[model samples]
Target: MQERLNIVPFVSVDHMMKLVLATGVERFLIELAAYIEEDFRRWECFDKTPRIASHSAEGVIELMPTSDGEAYGFKYVNGHPKNTRFGRQTVTAFGVLADVGNGYPILLTEMTILTALRTAAMSAVAAKYLAPKGARTMAMIGNGAQSEFQAIAFKAILGVDKLRLYDIDPSATARCQKNLAGMGFEITACSSSQEAVEGAEIVTTVTADKQYATILTDNMVGPGIHINAVGGDCPGKTELHRDILLRSDIFVEYPPQTRIEGEIQQLDPDHPVTELWKVITGQVPGRSGGRQITLFDSVGFAIEDFSALRYVRDRLKETGLYEELDLLADPDEPRDLFGMILRAAKPTPVAATVGAL
Candidate 1:
């Protein structure tokens, strides 16, 4: 039997990649979305809060933490848009899950790939509830590492097959197009956000610039569209114009956090926005009318990460893609930790050494 207290299962970047490939990205996303939805249904059971962030001129680093009464989880993530200039990823992360009863870590895993997956899955989940009925097209405003995953998730979850893509850098758009070429999407590369949003029922603005960017103006956002505003995920970072927010009914993961980090930050602190969990649990309406615009102001959240950690923990048993890490000290007696170290320092016995000689 495995000694659960002393060993932590570590899923490295390589193992994460293997697990993702083995699971098939689309299937994994669909499965993860199910888990997210399940957690959202029981939203009141979790301990929730805004991510704690450290800011810098170049980017921001954040720690997202959450817990159910039984288990605890946290993710350390960084967002440095300028890192792309040095050929590095703009966002990277890792996470840990621990037993709340014992305060022992149970799992450690690379969360960079997982974050991309979960973010896309979360967006898809929101879109499924809030998007226009029979919505088939989407405008992907920013083409970064996250763009392809968003495309795949929407395809798997919402049956969206037509994509209109626009990025300020043409190379980024080309990369997104090439990555999604064989994915059965009818993708059109556009020169501007306006061209991309045209004729699309769902408009997703995921730009990377850390400014108050107006990627979508009020006039450009017609009624009856669902806006997935993802990139405006931190204070001082937003994509939609304030006027657009005034015209749309916004749905958020956590209002306290979204008020600080999401596009809703541009609105009045007391402005009304529906909590998505309530919609998922049938406590409130999602898409009320054919002409009402619904906006999912997503800033990512801790419960989503908690759900992801739970999913990964469940997958580890089936895939065996993780390694055992000797992360905790286990002594013959729990209180004799100092004595255990002393005994190890005593070295091999002289009699045993002579017998071997």
Candidate 2:
């Protein structure tokens, strides 16, 4: 076995970008989805909980932790919807994976981009089971950094070929259109959320606001549409109206977490919502009929982050897109940590000669 204090693999932002580019974003999403699905199938083995969050007036900071008996993982993430005004990303994250045997981190990686990738992947996974049959078009209501990734993941996973884009900021929609040019998508930039969701099979609401703003009113939602609500992730944040939750068959990653953070927070605490893992594992039914509305109230869970971290860790060996970080102390003896620090304090021969002079 390798020494625990030798070095930990660190994947910085630049290295992560390189790895994603080399692997191809769509392919990476597909592969990452596979890992997530695999974990969900064996869901009973992992220790799960709602993410720990600290809310501020401007944003929220969250720590998501999980363990699967053998390995442990956690992610530190923050969300600030107003950050764009200062030319900063709305969400940024980093994650660590450690050995359960020794409690030492084995990998540390930037999760800002990885979070987007995994969120898209997780949405696609849910859509596969909950979306209408033969779904091809998706109305993307938010065209920020996560827009292209969501479009591509749906395309790669659910064969979605058409995209209708809209954003409160027209510039964001334009940027999304420019980024998705010639990506085999029949794209349209709509002027309003109503226009975007018109005649769409899947309506994805990902607007970033720290309030209970209704991006999609109940009147706007129709039958046979899968609502991928991604942005309403904090206590007071929500996208769809309360009536929409009543009419749809809601599916969530974890109810305890989603109840506090997801769109379903508007509903009763004990409202019936399907656990998504059960659907993936065939323990329950999804999309019972063409007219049934399915809502995936995604709040971003720890297990999804764990799956994404594991996927990146596995890929690092092949791509060599990581740096070795001296993140731990390597003492001569495990119990002599203080002695190791004291030994390093001894002067070198050059220092001793200069002192004598």
Positional deviation of residue 168's Cα in model 1 after best superposition, in angstroms: 0.5
What does the lDDT come to for candidate 1? 0.92
Error of 2 at 353 (Å): 24
User: Which 10 consecutive positions of candidate 2 have the poorest summed lDDT?
Assistant: 348-357
| Candidate 2 per-residue C-alpha lDDT over 1-357 given as tens digits, one digit per residue, 9 for 90 to 100 | 244465899999999999999999889999999999999998889999888888887888999999999999999999888998899998999999999999999999999999999999999999999999899999999898988999999999999999999999999999999999999999999999999999999999998878899899999999889999998888988999999999999999988999999998898899999999999999999889989999999999999999999999999888999998878876656698787667668955543343123
lDDT of 2 at 4: 45
Q: After superposition, how far is residue 38 of candidate 1 from its true place, in Å?
A: 0.6
Candidate 2 yields a Cα-based lDDT of 0.92
**Model 2 / residue 244 / CA error / Å:** 1.0
Mind giving the per-residue lDDT tens digits that candidate 1 earns over 1-357? 255566899999999999999999999999999999999999999999889999998899999999988999999999998998899988999999999999999999999999999999999999999999889999999998889999999999999999999999999999999988888999999999999999999999888988899999888999899999999999999999999999899999999999999998888899999999999999999999989999999999999998999999999988999999878876556798896677667744642232223
For each of the candidates, the C-alpha root-mean-square deviation to the true structure, in angstroms, is 3.5, 4.0
Instruction: For candidate 1, report its TM-score.
Output: 0.96
Q: Which 10 successive residues of model 1 have the least lDDT summed?
A: 348-357
